[model samples]
Target: MKKPSRIVNFLYRLVGMSYVHESVSEVREALAEHSVGTVAERWARIHAQGAEKLQHPLDFQPGLIDLHDEMHDMWRYLVALRNQASRGMSAHLADELEEAADFMGEVLHHVGLAAEATIPDASLDRGPGSTWINIPAPPAL
Candidate 1:
């Protein structure tokens, strides 16, 4: 995921934003089932929907439904629970997903990392349903 500006990050933190890196169990579950296709859909969403055209449009969200609806339902759970900042991060992810042509490949490459070691790392050991898509943070400026 692209780095959010300091101001945006602060604002997100100020709002207690539990987004982006936060665990969304549905995504993990979809990954468990569809695996590569789950991440592929996110990439496909960027190509088809184009974050530039719509607001926070994501593969897992409610905007465009090109691939499987199962993924959408997974992210939808997070949408229902989190605030707008969370949704905005979905937009951020979608935007970055477009730029990240090999994103799906990366995720799929690391798919066998015992859950905790997955690309977008989240810990099921953390507690009930604790699974996050920890997109790698950008390098230091």
Candidate 2:
């Protein structure tokens, strides 16, 4: 298997360090505890912090710009959720949060694939039926 690119490896590490999984778990726990008031607050805080922390690194690559923008969108969604929660928990709020999470997950999936893409190396191939050939280097004067 081809090794992941440096960007991909870095992003994976950042994702791990960002406590995304823990935040998700916390949201679930909040739901179980009927603490919907804090759910949006916590979600917004986590994603906003992640976006800020990653902004500089992500800005260094053009290919990463879209992912960075998507992270901002996630923060916006969380803010919307917070607004919805302020009116009291509703099934609609739950559905919206779930949908937002799913979208963010999809974005992360694409980021992983983009980062893991193998760069083509022309030297690795020879024409059909070609035998190995070595060229000697010239001696330095």
Candidate 3:
């Protein structure tokens, strides 16, 4: 019955489960500098990678975070993978994005199942934990 917090909503968008208006011009903007041929090639390659890639089974245990700093590693690895793909520096994502998205989805899913649990389970922190560092929000364009 409760709505997702702002932080959870941000995660949703990050994993491509939600839509935002700002990125609507993404392809057009990309084409501004690169030619149609280059864009086409990259798009095909990305889709190919998505299909051909075999993501290893995620090691997410339970609850919000793991002791191995999996959340931070997932974020860092995903950004590096995306950056590499974006720059055309590397097509292999190492399945990091899928892993990160799965990790985040596990977090959200854990918080979500709280309501369905037979016993009370309110101990979960639905957002960033106390040990998690704070990063200032980026300046609005």
Candidate 4:
């Protein structure tokens, strides 16, 4: 199968990176609010806001559907944790929260790799449509 052009790959990676950033920020906020005993209604609001924010970027990259679902699952877990804490059922939640944070870090690392892979190598010659221009330096004074 023919590989996608570098431009296409770069666009996909850029959009994916944006989605990952938004997801990470939302999860971090949710986790912080949960730790502070935020109410269930507030959690629901945050969930809706995060979903809305991610919808467009997620649509840009069809390959990330699974990741999008995983994000929702993580958000649900955070909301549940908040509910549990509110009910005085806190037990090992700190550990769970830490795990979630670690998972997000891993996701960020992977997405960063995907984005980085598309960057043009500095040592490679620019192909067709390259805009780089080399001008000879003026004679030394």
Put the candidates in TM-score order, highest first.
2, 4, 3, 1
Residue 101 lDDT in candidate 3:
59
Error of 1 at 96 (Å): 3.2
Write candidate 4's Cα lDDT for 1-141 as tens digits: 243465876888888732232465667875775666547666667656544543333232332445555765675676566566656565566556656756765675675454334334635736554233333332232
**Off by more than 4 A, model 2:** 1-61, 65-87, 121-141
Q: Pick the candidate with the highest lDDT.
A: 2
Better of 2 and 3 by lDDT: 2
Worst 10 residues of 4 by lDDT: 132-141
Ranking by lDDT: 2, 4, 3, 1
**Candidate 1 per-residue C-alpha lDDT over 1-141 given as tens digits, one digit per residue, 9 for 90 to 100:** 454666898889998983353356755854565646656766666555453443321222222222224444444544443444346667665554444434443443343232233323353345555334333332232
* Per-candidate RMSD, Å: 19.8, 19.0, 20.3, 21.8
Measured against the true structure, the TM-scores of the candidates, in listed sequence, are: 0.17, 0.29, 0.24, 0.27
How high a TM-score does candidate 3 get?
0.24
State the C-alpha lDDT per candidate.
Answer: 0.45, 0.56, 0.50, 0.53
TM-score of model 1 (CA atoms): 0.17
> Candidate 3: worst 10 consecutive residues by lDDT?
55-64
Q: Candidate 4 overall Cα lDDT vs. reference? A: 0.53
Q: What is the lDDT of candidate 1?
A: 0.45
